[model samples]
Target: MSQSVAARPRSLWRDRNFLTMWSGQALSQFGEQITGLAIPVLAVLLLHATEFEVGLLNAAGVAAFLVVGLPAGAWIDRMRKRHVMIWADAVRAVALATVPVLWWLGWLDIWHLIAVALVFGIATVFFDVSYQSIVPSLVPAAQIPEANGKLESTQQLAGIAGPAIGGWLIGILTAPLAVLATVGTYIASFIALCLTRDTEVVAPRDEHEPLLRSIGEGLRWVFGNRYLRRIVGTTGVSNLFSTISFTMLPIFILRDLGLSPEAMGVIFSLGAIGGLLGAMATPHIVRWIGEGRAIPVSAIGFSVIGLFLPVAALAPAVAFPLLVAQSFVASFTVLLYNIVQVSFRQRITPKRLLGRMNASVRFCVWGVMPLAALAAGGLGAWLGVVPTMWIGAIGGLVSAAFVVFGPFWAMRELPAALEEADADASR
Candidate 1:
């Protein structure tokens, strides 16, 4: 009997529900990568946007994360997560489709682009918060890391291929038409989501309770927990600094380094290979470091690597390669952090509180991304791009100090509650 059990193939292949969600996620991520290329290319090429304007666009996206995160979490808790995902996909499809239409009408402008980015970003927050909350309900706790690893791996593959495709498509059809491809990808994802079959999530029974009260409870529950508070604080500080660094990177590349669009695309694609390697290696990393120790260390590692970007300008020939190295290290470190953090959160969070908790986390962490972008752009405008990048790097170093010095650094094993849950699932 033991031999027979051991002989069974370890794969998510037999799980039809996970398969459906994974396939849809793969397609959605591909579309997202294309847009990540399309948006900046469109701004720089078509609208002749200034550095500040480009930063504004990025800020617009994160602004959505800030504004809608908590409410969306509450809203998600009130409906089936799958339904929320389908609706979010449908909304994104419509938002992306508008780009091609407006471009054809000679009505394309930065405002239109920013609007699309913001709305699509909001929908994405809803989809992501719900998706993260629902995954634990769909799979046993032991499979959580495997599922997240596969998802991260798919994201890396998309990062590699999607930008290459987007770059080529832009070269052939121009930026506006390149966006249409993303629209189609979203439609495919929407259909796939609609096809997903799983046990429906029941909305929590709280009809007499006010929405604000429920939202407040979620906020309290997430922030009230000792473990959750530490995770949020660590992630929020890390993200803020990283955002500042990222916001300045494009400016430093274009204005200071004088790299071309095609060159930047290649650099991004090459950097994506780092994420692929990171994803492939996460399971092993978790085992080696132990999941608890992995999170804070990886978070610190990611922050440390951010300092390398500003140092790239010293040698033009080696600058791009150094930047690529930064990308690789950043991808690896961030993925390691994510796999552990997401799995830990999934294990600890109750099903009823999942949506609100996930959203609240995003609200706090990514909420500052846009502000950081704006500050980087403004500071770069005042101090010059190189100086701004130096400041950003310094900020990154400071960010790491918080998590490394905190109590989180000593977490060398799974929490007691989570270990018990994992044991239960393995049975």
Candidate 2:
């Protein structure tokens, strides 16, 4: 025990390769923030793109997930994840770099932005899947939760910091110039990944394997697990409603409450701080409540806390405070639930199937987001944003019930991967 305690100083923080990869991702996350905000602003402000065209641009960005969400996983399983990530970053960097050059030459148009969005998004799908799959290979098994927590924490930090930096860039230079600034971060990510030594040399997958069959195998593995199936159901439903309500949020704040755009931004920023706090709290909460119990309990919280958003109409005097409080708690619960379940899923899945497993999860959960957004628009128009939000909150309760009343409540720890399954993907 004494020796074990002494040896604990050796961690992923001390690993040069891990540090290199993390630094690269950190730069990418921070830099990417400027462009995400700048791109749409550029279309509306400089390109003179109409509202419909801007909508098309936003739609094109996420359409790739619905297009390749499942197959990307199968393809990722066939190659090295680290290599996939490197290429994704490189492609995004190159695509973003084109914007300023095109603008300078007077060749840039709304179509140019749309094209960039499509390519950037496609690359994002690959990068997101690859990074999640690769983490298990990057560190010791015991450190995976810690690694996830750190990564998530950095992402939230980026979320907070990204907007501030993006806002600063916009004030100093135009949105296109801000986008140009983001290109460096992606370049840094590519370089960091290139410099980091990745040991994984994936075994040859049957090139002749029917693509659909490979996809099916991944879907089967995820849904076959009792815990995973419920997790999928829980997250998918939660996302579905969450999107439904959140899509109409700005309208509620700006139009209904009569707040300024800056005030609205402040509300979201303040709310988002909860996610950062939740990431830091994850490891401690998991230990205190036990992983299995922690998940369902957190699930209950977000939906219940979310009710405050719509219900705030009852007390308009304090509605702003209520909405801010709702966002903070909901962000906390949502982030905590995600980290716990993501780490849980990574620990229990086979390495060969990591790509497919993550892909399938993304496929199921993300597929509904666009649809939910469309639904929110329709419902917000038909029934008003407040009533639609109430509907979404109610739906959240139903989603939470999947795990809140299930076996996880009585359980302590989540299951480890079966010993036989641990040997290989063949299981």
Top lDDT hit = 2
Off by over 4 Å in 1: 2-10, 204-208, 416-427
TM-score of 1: 0.92
What is the per-residue lDDT of model 1 for residues 262-322, given as tens digits with 9 covering 90 to 100? Answer: 6676777888998898888878887787767777788778888987888897777899899
lDDT minimum window of 10 residues, candidate 2: 418-427
Whole-model Cα lDDT of every candidate shown, in order: 0.80, 0.81
| TM-scores for candidates 1 onward, in order | 0.92, 0.87
The CA lDDT at 17 in model 1 is 79
Give one digit per residue, the lDDT tens place, for model 2 in 352-406: 8889999999888877766676677677768877898898888888788889878
Q: Quantify how close model 2 is to the true structure by its C-alpha RMSD in Å.
A: 3.5
lDDT of candidate model 1 versus the reference: 0.80
